[model samples]
Target: MYVRTSEVRGDPARLDEGLRLIREEIYPAVTAMDGCAGMSVLFDRNICRVVATTSWRSEDAMWASTETVRALRESAERALGGTGGSEVHQWEVAVAHHDHPVPDGAHARLTWMSCKPALIDRAVDLFRMVALPQIQEFDGFCGTTLMVDRGAGRIVGTAAVESRGAIESSRDAAAMIRERFSTELDATVDGVEEMEVAFAHLHVPEMV
Candidate 1:
C-alpha cells in the first residue's frame, strides 16, 4: 500500500472545526476516489498538530491524486487556522499487523527514523521479529504499522494502543526497543509524538 501523510500545525481551539471538515468533506471525497484504500487522522491537541493519512492501493493511484489531495489539505489547513505550511510525506506500507480492530478512544505513538537505504530490509525484519513482539507485551496493544520511504531512508512507525495510559506505561520499554533498533540499523531518531486516533477506516484488506 502507498500512503500520503500531511502534517499540519494549527490552532488548538479550531481543532474541532478542522476535524469536522475532514470528516464531512475530505473523507467522502477521498473514499470515493479510485483505488483509495483508507484514510485516518491523528491529532495532538496539546500541540495543535494533526497528521492526516490517506492510503492508496498503488503508488500510481497515490501520485495521480496529488493535485486533488493538495487542494483538500489546503482547505482543511485554512479551516483549522494552520500557521506554517504543511509537510507531506509519501511512503510504502512495509509492515502491518492487525491485533484487533482499532477501538474508540485509541491512541498512537509515532516514531520517526532515518536510516541508510541498504538497511531497509533488515530494519523491517528487526521490527517484525524484535520490536513488534516487545511492544505486544504491553497492555492495550492494538496494532502497529511501519511505513517507509526507501529512497529517502525515512521511516515512520506507528503503534496503536487503547489509551494514553497504555502509551505512558509502555514508554520506557518502547523507547529502549526503538533505540536498540535504531542503533543496529544506524538510524537517527528524529522524534516521537503521542496522538489520539481521531478517525480510522480501511477499505483495503489486511496485509498479513
Candidate 2:
C-alpha cells in the first residue's frame, strides 16, 4: 500500500474547526476516489497538532485522485497558513500491523505506556531491547519510531507492523517487551487508542 502522512500545526482555538472540516469535508473527497483505501486523522490536544494519514493502491493512483481535488487541497493549505501550500510525503507501506481493524492490506497498532517520571529510562531501555527488535524482525516490519515527551512525562512507542497478522498478534509485541524490558512491575499499559483516517473535501469543487 502507498501511504501519505502529514502534520499540520495551527492555532489551538481553530483546532475544532480544522478537525470538523477534515472529518466533514476533506475525507469524503478521498474516500470517493478509485485508489483510496482508508484514512485516519489524529488530533493531539496536548501538543496542538493534527496528523492525517491515508492509504492508496498506488502512487500514480494517489496523484490522479489528488489532481481532482486541487481546490479542496488548497483550502487545507490555507488552513495551515501556507501560501503555496504543503504536500504530504509519500511512503511505501512495506509492512503494517495494528490492533484496530484495518483494510484488507493495511495494518496498524498503537501501544501506549504510562509511568512515573523516574521510570522513564527503564521504559526506553525496554523498548529498545525488547519491543523494537520484535517489530523489526516481523516479515513486513518497515520502520518504527519512539516518541518521548519529557515535559508531559509521556512515552509513546509506535511500531509499524508488516502485515495483518503482525498487527493482530500484538500480544507477542507486549510479551517481548515484558520479557526483555519490564523493569517496573507497576508499569501498566493504560490504553490502546484505535486510530481512524481523516479525509477532506470542499463544498464547492471550484471554491478554494
Candidate 3:
C-alpha cells in the first residue's frame, strides 16, 4: 500500500469551520475518487496543525490522483487559514495493524526516526518483532502504523490510543521503550507529535 500526507499549519481560530469543510466537502470528494482506499486526519490544536492522509491500493493510484488531490489540499489548507500551501509526502506502508474498533475520542502519537538507508530492513524487523507486541499491551491502545520513505531512510510510526489521559500516563514508559528501540535500530529520533485522530476511515489492510 502507498500513502500521501498533506500537512498544513494554520489559524487555530478558523479550526471549527475548516473541520466542517473537510467533513462535508473535501472528504466525500476524495473518497469517491478512483483507487482511493481510505483517509484519516490528524490535528494538533495547540499548534493549529492538521495533517490529512490518504491511502491508495497502489503507487500508480496515488500518483494518478496527485494533481486533483493537490487542488483539494490547497482548498482545505486555506479553509484552515493557510496562505502558501501544504507540505506533501508519499510513503510506502510497511505496517498497519488494528483489530479493535476505534472508540470515541481516539488520540495518536507519532514518532519520526531516521536510520542509514542500509539498515532500513533491520529497523523494520526490530519494530515488528519486538516493539509492536510490547506496545499492544499499553493501556487503551488501539493500533499502530509504520510508514517508510526508503530512499530517504525516514520512518514515521503512529500509535493510536483511546484518549488523552492514557497518553499522559504512558509517556514515561513509551519514551524509555522508544529510546531503546531506536538504539537497537541504530536510528536517531527526529521528533514526536501528539494529536487527536480527527477522523480515521482507513481501510488499510493489516500488514505485519
Who wins the lDDT comparison?
1
Per-prediction CA RMSD (Å): 1.1, 12.5, 1.1
Measured on C-alpha atoms, candidate 2 has an lDDT of 0.54
lDDT of 1: 0.89
Residue-level lDDT of model 2, residues 1-208, one tens digit each, is 5655555666666666777777777888777888887666655544445667666777787677656655665666566443453445555442233432323343444555556767666666666665665776655553454444344345555454445566666656555664444355356664453232232211111100
How many clashing pairs in candidate 1? 0
TM-score of each: 0.97, 0.49, 0.96
> What is the C-alpha lDDT profile of model 3 across 147-193, one tens digit per residue?
99999998988888899988777788779879988988889999888
Report the poorest 10 consecutive residues by lDDT, candidate 2.
199-208
Candidate 2 TM-score, true structure as reference: 0.49
Clashes of 3: 0
In model 2, the runs with Cα more than 4 Å from the true position are: 79-87, 102-208
